[model samples]
Target: MLKDFKAFIMRGNVVDMAVGVVIGASFGGIVKSLVDDVLMPPIGLLLGRVDFSNLYLILREGTAPGPYAALAEAKKAGAVTLNLGLFANTVINFIIVALAIFLVVRAVNRLQAMQKSKEPEAAPSTRECPFCASTISIKAVRCPQCTSALAE
Candidate 1:
């Protein structure tokens, strides 16, 4: 059982999956930062200086009866809130990540296509003999099966 477990752990795919998961987690963090710090600010500024971070609706009022300044304040006050801005921000993050992945995949596919194009094309190995009812090499000047002269 231990040996089986060890074999499973040592497999190339398992190791690769683990590495991918770790990298993906870090990549998620970077994307999140990109959405929050870099992208949102410019977008917010473009949209008439609207701050997305603080945009929320209080579903149920907490101890306070009226307007809350931020999402955090509402949360801290035990308010049920709809974080519309956060949801929108997350959607944007998803789009950015998806676009990046699409571009990478497109580039990889292009490279693969280029590699395939670079490979030397193989010559035809077999051809139907006109004189005989048999298949023969395309290079053959004569059909071996029927012993007939073949045309060029």
Candidate 2:
């Protein structure tokens, strides 16, 4: 059982999957930062400095009364709030990551297709035997299936 488990873990697919998972996590982090830090800031600035992360709806009043400026402030006051901005940020992050993966897959598929098209095809070098109708090499002097001699 232990050897079988070791073989399973050492397989090409399993190793590739582990590498993919690690790279995917790293890519997710980069995309998250790009969305939150790079993209959101410009969008917020263009929209009159409206910070989307702070955009939320308070469902219940907390110890601190109405008029909460930021989502962090509302959370600090124990207010139950719907975080629409964070959700939007997450959506943007997902789109970026998905697009990146799609582009990579498209490129890999194109490369593999091109490689397949470039390979030379081998010509068939065999023919059917006159007596037995069995396939035999053009260089054969006798049919192996029927032991019949052939014309030169």
Candidate 3:
């Protein structure tokens, strides 16, 4: 059982899948940062100086006061808040990751198509006999019906 388990773990596809999962997780982090740090900030500034990360609704007021300045402050005071800003950022991260994956898949598909196009097609093997005018295999040394010698 242990040997079978080791054999399964050592299979090329399983190892490749594990590597892909790790790389995908790292790529997701990069994409999330790109969306939050690069894209959202500019778009948020254009809309207004409103910080998307702080946008939230307080379900229950914090112990300190009626108005909470930020989500972190509200959370620090043990307030039950609906964090819309973080959700927005998460949505942006998902969109960016999905688009990146789509582009990669598309490019891989195109490369595969190009490779298929580059492959040489098998030529037709049967040919007409020169002397007898009969269809015969190109590999045949002599015509079956006429006994005519086939060309090399």
Candidate 4:
């Protein structure tokens, strides 16, 4: 059982998948940071200096007070709230990641297509006999079975 488990773990595909998962997780973090720190700030500024991360709706008042400045403050005060800003940031992050993945896939497909185009087409190995309607070698000038002269 241990040997079987080891074999499964040692497989090339499993190892590659593990590596991909780790890299994808790292990429997700990068995309999250880009959305939160880079993109959202400028967009929020353009919308009259509104802080997107603080944009939320208070469902119910907290123990502290009716008004909570930020999502963190609301949560800290035990208030039921809808974090719209956070949701927006997450959606942006997902879009960036999806686009990146799409571009990578498109590039890989193009490279494969180019490689296929570069490869030489295989020469024909066989031909049909004109007289007998039978398969024969391409090099044959006459049909062996039918004994008929074949055109070049």
Model 1 collision count = 0
Which numbered prediction scores highest in TM-score against the true structure?
A: 4
CA lDDT of 30 in candidate 2? 96
Cα lDDT of model 1 by residue, 80-132, tens digit: 99988899889988998899889989999999999999999998899998876
Over 61-109, each residue of candidate 3 has an lDDT whose tens digit, in order, gives: 8787758888899999889999998999999898888898999999999
Question: What's the CA error at residue 128 for candidate 2, in Å?
Answer: 6.2
Cα misplacement distance, residue 41 of candidate 4 (Å): 1.1
Error of 4 at 38 (Å): 1.0
Model 1 worst lDDT window (10 residues):
64-73
Q: What is the TM-score of each candidate against the true structure?
A: 0.76, 0.82, 0.76, 0.85
lDDT of 3 at 44: 85
- Two-way lDDT contest, 2 vs 3, winner: 2
Candidate 3 minimal-lDDT segment of 10 residues = 61-70
So what's the TM-score on candidate 1?
Answer: 0.76
lDDT (10s digit) by residue, model 4, range 1-152: 99999999999999999999999999999999899899999999999998989999999978999677778999999999988999999899989999999999999999999999999999999999988999999999989999999999
lDDT of each: 0.90, 0.94, 0.91, 0.93
Model 3, residue 37: displacement in angstroms? 1.4
Q: Put the candidates in TM-score order, highest first.
A: 4, 2, 3, 1
What total of clashing residue pairs does each candidate reach? 0, 0, 0, 0
Residue pairs in steric clash, candidate 4? none
RMSD of 3: 4.5
Model 4 gets an lDDT of 0.93
